[model samples]
Target chain A: MNYPNGKKGSLTQPSQSRPSGAGNHAFSNRGMTLEEDINETNRFYLDTDKAIIHKKPTPVQIVKVNYPKRSAAVITEAYFKQASTTDYNGVYRSKHIDFEAKETKNKTLFPLANIHNHQVAHMRSVVEHGGICFLLIRFTLYQETYFLPAEKLFQHWDDKLKGGRKSISYDQICQEGHQIPFQYQARIDYLAIIDKLYF
Target chain B: MNYPNGKKGSLTQPSQSRPSGAGNHAFSNRGMTLEEDINETNRFYLDTDKAIIHKKPTPVQIVKVNYPKRSAAVITEAYFKQASTTDYNGVYRSKHIDFEAKETKNKTLFPLANIHNHQVAHMRSVVEHGGICFLLIRFTLYQETYFLPAEKLFQHWDDKLKGGRKSISYDQICQEGHQIPFQYQARIDYLAIIDKLYF
Candidate 1:
């Protein structure tokens, strides 16, 4: 399929050769970050009229700005601020879709430290309000992305709070999460899983 | 009512007195900008479990950064980028809510120049996807905030494209739009109109 932008093969392929074995199987889309994959997928969804999701801009606290006479305003001093909500959110099939994409290099388990408390609270609010909330987690070692519902994530988060396992094992993820099938255009075809779960 | 953060009366009342006339009646919530009022209203909505809406962060293109040892990374150079979507969006009563807020100081008409072409396109996509979309316009001179539905906005937008009036008259806004009632907590109580119109 023809991609809208000419960034077709550049983002999906790895730049350098990797050692063979199980790692070789993860070569497809090796260099692309989970954020890039999801952004591409969201763009595809928008282009196809399938969804209207978008990644919110990175939050920043602007301290100073300089407006040149003939030029655009330049922000000279700023700092990154912790986001109060997830990275991506929008409407899909008349439902509000909210999710955070995370990637871990570990193959055995996904660490809970990647997520913050406020994000969990935000996800809970979304779920309570009848919106579709979840996590798009990519295990880089296997190049396998999984869709874990917010409800399922809350269980592990609560357990972590109660001094339980700090991470969800790969086996547990395999059991609880649905593997997102990678495609040429929609690299992370998450809506396919959403259709089955929600629709 | 007690406003959170103790910013109660500070933002609502003007710092100085105004001469008695049509302009005098606009003193309520005079100093606060449209953005500030809506943000305060959204915070109230969130606190009351009424809605889960939030304004997207201002999009910025970071060009340079300095990583000081044992200190937060400082963005040394950046420029504001145009947003691809509306300012505020979230879920309310199981329905996706998306909107852009604009303010006009002119008493007779609101210039269409405040909104961009891409924002209108984003609103159209939101509406086509069955999400509730609208514009919150604040007439600062009259202290009136109106909720103009996306469907109504498109007619005016298309007219502008066809070499029609570049601004929507105040009378037209009064006729086609619903005036949002100002409240103590929910400064720009827009959902009141949404409940009547959509729910």
Candidate 2:
């Protein structure tokens, strides 16, 4: 919807409007989703023995499958399952790392609704367990990303419940979150922030 | 499909023959599969403040979707894209953690085929990055799971290509891989192994 700064596509628009069988065929993802960039970065880290990180498989509830003669089984029936944890996680230098990567067209504020209840709880556990926990928020329109700690997220979440704001203003994020730099090698360059914040 | 111990289920068995729609869906976990378990463990860690780990979402190439109503959109056409990294990843205690999980009915040996070519490359990258990387191997029949390091997996994989064994014997896994105990609190007691191995 209307991002705090009057930027980005409304969630209702992209998520709701769809052509028939639009999702069944594979789309090229010409523009990278946040997940892809992070995955590429993780690969670079792994290739150089720098870090190890991977995106977990989508949680799917398969209802049926089609077995075509001597071929990899095809999932004919399935539904998305609610995720129980953040999107990305791993270990670095013997320390636990956890985070969720999200993209928003909004140039100003990030919506809390984009963060799920279970995910919030999951991040809480990471912080409690002494792990580095945060969210990689991307302003797709601005092509900028910020790392927001779960604590700040919780604080804003409670604030939202009290009807203070619908989203985290860009100014608030810039004030509270660390801006992540982009590099050809690491792509997302998140570990740099981790080095500064957690290490 | 024949497991190492002599149990066999036709790999050719129709994927649809398994009618997994109903039953103990909570723990039943039909398609959520092994990755879901890892994600759940990550959530538990986030909630309890133990360790932080997560599996990335499936990189689906969604080409077609059907929207019968404004409120519902169903993916009608999609294809699996090749993944460049391992499935599960994150950080623990500031140290990067990365891995993949697989389940097999075979009792004798885990097939190298189960581990893909690209994934092997991904694991190698993690090793290069100075991060902890491994695989969670589950024997569904015996209900046994093992955490096998990528190094060992790589070695076996290479050996197989050179005309050695087609799989790693379970006995060998028991010797080289860390046995992941099943705990009521955290279904897969992987963090315990992390504590023992890295901490």
Candidate 3:
């Protein structure tokens, strides 16, 4: 869990977190992190047939396979593949949905670099085609998650390229984003924002 | 490439013909066959700045790694993680483009079983939200590809569940799908249809 030479536990630290269940060790205090909570919420959504959202699977490339005696073939060599789309996407109330989820511990700001250029591009397309695209930013320090529309994020991202701030300030996020509440069942309560914005 | 199942020019065949640049061995074509072609098309899209689509990375649960003589660490033990989203996605003309690319040698129809329930559910969301969602089905035997929208595909899928035909006939596909031309550059010129339909 020790990251070398950088201020650890900042807003973007979760990027260093293991992408799957194993990453839980990094956030021992929180028990289940924001992803797990949202996953549970998504499951509830599916079970109830209210809305269908899912976190995309991680991509891998298998290089070698081993066929042991009288057993199923085993994959021996594989490498990770770059993802082309956002992490989460699905349907809600007959609408197409697409988005990415990010968590940061920094109390004051969220780094724009945490998002890849392609993801920004993907979100832009989602919005253009009439899909609701946004980022679920979790300020772990404040235990707060905000749904920031992609349009706003993209403007700030382009501005940064033209000598603006590297990150979006917490104040701006507070002003623009819908603050998502935490619940035991639907931990992120993102659907509340979705309902308000799209419905 | 001849498969043991009497199929010709199959990507799944270890003895299939390969283009010049790829590695020259049986080990190279070990993973999903269509994945590389789609990725190359995506790369072309990005390089040309035509669209910003990408295939999601594979999800792996890395259980163990071996450091052998300062080379790339060899992954010794791992398990595949289930995917929550479709394979390919991006933006075209400021719209969200998301889809799964599947190839079947069979010329008659596409099997609903090849696609998972979860993926269908995810596509449903894209349609609901107004995103251009579809399935790129390649009839390898016919050297033809079709872009079937989520709505059209889902209808047949629903009928299948109700004890209808297990597959969609090529005649039905011709009626429902928009033909995608295979250019040497883009490979599949799907956006043209998108332009005609959505624009």
* DockQ of all candidate complexes: 0.82, 0.27, 0.24
Off by over 4 Å in 2: A1-49, A55-58, A70-74, A91-94, A140-143, A181-188, B1-59, B81-84, B87-97, B101-107, B127-131, B138-147, B161-163, B178-191
lDDT tens string, model 2, A138-181?
Answer: 87655567889889898998888898887999999989998866
Residue B50 C-alpha lDDT in model 1: 89
The most accurate candidate by DockQ is 1
After superposition on all C-alphas, the RMSD of every candidate to the true structure, in Å, is 5.1, 9.5, 8.7
Cα deviation at B146, candidate 1, in Å, is 0.6
TM-score of 1: 0.88
- Residue range A116-137, candidate 3, lDDT tens digits: 9878877776676567789999
Judging by TM-score against the true structure, name the best candidate.
1
**Pick by TM-score: 2 or 3, better one:** 3
TM-score of each: 0.88, 0.67, 0.69
Q: What's candidate 2's DockQ score?
A: 0.27
lDDT per residue as tens, model 1, B1-199: 2333323232244432122244555544345667888999999999999899999999999999999999999999999999999999999999999999988877799899988999999999999998999999888655678999999889999999999988899999989999876666788789998999998
Q: Rank by lDDT, highest first.
A: 1, 3, 2
Which tens-of-lDDT digit does each residue in A22-100 have in candidate 1?
A: 4564643345667777988999999999999999999999999999999999999999999999999999999999999
Q: Give the per-residue lDDT digits (tens) of candidate 3, residues B1-199.
A: 1123323333444444332234454544532345555776677876776776767666667766677786766676676666666877666775667899887766587887888887887787677655679988877655466889889989988998899988888888889998775455555667778888888
CAPRI quality of model 3: acceptable
DockQ of the two-chain complex in candidate 1: 0.82
DockQ winner between candidates 2 and 3: 2
